[model samples]
Target: MTSFTRPFILAAALATLPLTALADPSVAPAKDSLEIDEPGGVPAGYVLKWSDEFDKPGLPDPKLWAYDTKANKHGWANEERQYYSLARRENSRVEDGQLIIEARKEDLKNKPDWGGQHYTSARLLSKNSYQYGYIEVRAQLPCGLGVWPAIWQLPTTDHMMWPDDGEIDIMEYVGWDQDTIYHTVHTGLYNHVKHTQKGVLKHMPAVCGQWHTYSLTWTPDEIREGIDGRDYFRFVNEHTGKGAWPFDRPNHLILNLAVGGTFGGKTGVDDSTMPWQFRIDYVRVYQKPE
Candidate 1:
């Protein structure tokens, strides 16, 4: 599912450390510096378009964003370990021009719990949806065992059923090799079963603790993923019916910080690590032109 977008974070700096942590179940959340919409400026005709400045300090802005509560009860193919709530302070926050999403190893208020996991945090998505456009977000990811941070998109029509509906992982990291990041695409044809891999593994000069421009350029011709404005992976649709790339449909935006599950165990979540933060500077969307 190209779903699960989360905001709320700070600016990250170049840091070199082992990707996984040794389970600290009690480490307090770290502070970050993700300056929100600080006049990054826009290209002419590209338009400022849309964004979540996150300048206010509190819950996510009701008008521009909402939560995918389904994740709290188990959503996405990963079956991760966090319960996503709407605009919850414990999950998301804004301070000093940055938005933060802190996932912690703690019990939740599981009322009508749908087999929810022991982790707690936030997941946010853009209230609006689009099919073809250029979407970009500058952010600093969280680092800790079992920590999974991402910047991606999902169907706008709400593909209630995944796989059949399709899921795209623009950027998904499992905290194992903090130096490496991934960008994957999930579709009906080559899904969790086929063991197909359609992505680019970017080995950043440093881990995600540093601020960088991560984005996607989508058009009728192709879907490309990039970091720092450099294209590393791309996929295109073929009407001839050879390869399968079904990402032309409308999709919404998502930013999230997940804990642990199938993809995270390569290192393992350090449950002892409490309150890990994801800092975001700003999110900007641009239309390629009609």
Candidate 2:
């Protein structure tokens, strides 16, 4: 039952935001940028709220992870190719002080198989939800022409339904864009439609298969996305209005690795590709005094 729906084209105006392209030679496909960028960390005053150090090695931490077996096809933005299964080892597991979401290159001839995608991986979601604050997750990405890994959060409001329920894709990458990373937000305004807005940051640094701490700081005033402490993009909630600021509720976390789909086609995926994996050192969250 897990399937992918058509991608909603984001509005050209939102794509035009200054971060549309990252031009740093270190992270960008080619070096090009004028502003001098500096490094930053968890904003001052924020304290460690919650964390999963991955101390054990057999099945994921029950306190933090749960199987997402929803049968309805996920919009699966960007041509990502992945099918999430409930009890399959190929899809997820905890190992060696870390979490692994394995992506296999083969034919999936079973349940929830979209039919076309031959790769299987895990998309684990946190049953726990945090209302608002700074969230930090440290993990190394799996890099290959077709590998896609992400550490993001979503609203707990299944009651409101999707889109309106909202989603925050803090860190998402397709194997092809090895060095560069993408941070996105999907609300009612930009939920899988041609009229959505998105901001992309490029030319940061290498994050594939290496440890890097990714963070998201959400406040009533703004939403900021950072990599290893350095901020790449900020969305001003006040300037964007309520439609773009539906992040006012508790949002859960998700860690997943996907293969070629929408953005996957650009990089191309060969079923002969053997196996790929997504590694997570641990996940931690923080909340400031309310």
Candidate 3:
């Protein structure tokens, strides 16, 4: 389920540090020449339409990102335990040329909708949206039980609720299942709750410690997902109607690190693994040449 919700009742806390403290001066700037090991270069006809190399350090480019600060005591749907922070750098930051989203064990007892959750993290959404394109995210995942990190997409408009509008999960990892990564798609007619969602799991032993390119190529007829340029899953439109294919409209990107939730906490959380991090080196979107 989507982690978007409204604030609940809780007292406001005192002000915290400014955003400047989020930058890490010790980490040298990333070299612009750093290269990823994608299987091949851009496909023959696609053109780069947008990209965020995260070359700059600080809060994420304001022009490109917006925070998902909705707080719910019950984890927004999957029984998550993080209070998505919009004012704290302890949860989200840009450093050493990468976007770092961290989940820490700490309770903001006074914050609105504070439900005594002992963790805090960040969720970011791309301001821009597109109908169909080749989307790629280069990242090093976080590990340890209870950590659920994801790179996914959702419809840009609220014309319909989740599942009805569509959801594309390029990559989803649960620390307990440290060796497997999931690629899934949810629609009204096909969803996990109904036991009919379209998905696949790929085994990659070193996923947490190394950087990998997770990608999704969406077109009018189908959606394909992969890692390091090798596609492992494909879902095609069945022409059965919108219930099964709600991807025709523009969809925006979401990057988040959730803690101790339905899937991630199935094996139960190792609170000792309190603080975890998810890092993204770059995100790029390309469109087919007309």
Q: Which ten residues in a row have the lowest lDDT in candidate 1?
A: 10-19
By TM-score, how accurate is candidate 3?
A: 0.84
Our model 1 lands, by Cα RMSD against the true structure, at: 10.4
For each candidate in turn, the TM-score is 0.78, 0.78, 0.84
Q: Over 4 Å off in model 2, which ranges? A: 1-39, 72-80, 107-117, 160-162, 190-192, 239-241
Over 130-172, each residue of candidate 3 has an lDDT whose tens digit, in order, gives: 7788899999998789888889887665343656767888888
Q: What are the runs in model 1 whose C-alpha is more than 4 Å off? A: 1-45, 71-77, 110-116, 241-243
Cα lDDT for residue 217, model 2? 78
Clashes per candidate, residues 3 or more apart or on different chains: 33, 10, 0
Stretches of model 3 off by over 4 angstroms after superposition: 1-41
CA lDDT of each prediction against the hidden true structure: 0.62, 0.62, 0.73
Quickly count the clashes in candidate 3: 0
RMSD of each: 10.4, 8.3, 10.6
lDDT of 1: 0.62
